[model samples]
Target: MTLQQWCFSYRGRLSRRDFWIWQGVWLVAMVMLFTLAGNNWLDTQMAAFCVVCLLWPASAVMVKRLHDRNKKGWWALLVILAWMLLAGNWTMFNGTWQWALGRFVPTLIFVMMLLDLGVFTGTAGENRFGSEARPVNYFGKPNYQ
Candidate 1:
């Protein structure tokens, strides 16, 4: 798939390599934006912009990666759920252990998702998603089988 389609649309399988590359690029862009914008209102605005502009592409990448794993796109929502849990700042219990539990649970989910999506190989060939993941050269050209 083309770069535009890869980032904007969500209808294909993506190899782990492409998922890693695109995710790394997106993270770098987010870090640069936040760093350059500084810790002020502009930073908040930039963060908002990143949410609106950058987040969807990241989601698309993850969705495609999930597809490659022969999983439903809904699996990608785990990342968001983990993030939300981590940010929840649970105070349900007065005990400090509650915080630890909350953090640990989400962190565990994150680790599991990371391993499933990044470490494990995708389904050997297309199962239900689409064609096999075409290997790409350094310059992004398809390396046909």
Candidate 2:
């Protein structure tokens, strides 16, 4: 799939193959950014920005991951809102314990969500979210067939 198509196809299922491919792309991009940016402070900041840009695809992959488990993409909205609240609190308080709490708690929640995604398998056959991601063989039957 094209990167844009893969990123936007949140309504359907994702195969493990697709998920790993996107993750590899994310990791390679991040490594290249860090290696090329070097030690310059300005370059480091620019690389941070580039990392955020690269995270779009990663986030999209995560969304599809959630979808594979039959969860709604709206779950990502909660994650984003929690992050925004934490960031806002941190900015207002300037790194106090309260700020740390604001940031840390949401991060914990987000991490838990990711852990849940990792362990949960999608429903077999067609779920409300989409078709089974397991591939069909050349005989035009499911591999399990």
Predicted candidate 2 versus true structure: per-residue lDDT over 1-145, tens digit per residue: 3445476555566666677667677788877888878745348888989888766666776777677777777676767767776666454455666656687777887778756565566667777777776431224433333
All models, RMSD in angstroms: 2.8, 5.4
lDDT of each: 0.80, 0.67
Alpha-carbon TM-score of each model against the true structure: 0.84, 0.64
Give, for candidate 1, the lowest lDDT window spanning 10 residues. Answer: 134-143
Clashing pairs in model 1, backbone N/Cα/C closer than 3 A: none
Q: Which ten residues in a row have the lowest lDDT in candidate 2?
A: 135-144
Q: Evaluate residue 42 in candidate 1 and report its C-alpha lDDT on the 0 to 100 scale.
A: 57
Q: Give the true-structure RMSD of model 2.
A: 5.4
lDDT tens digits by residue: candidate 1, 44-136: 776777767887888888888888899999987888788888777678776676666678778888899889889999998667988887543
Q: What stretches of model 1 exceed 4 Å from their correct place? A: 39-43, 135-145
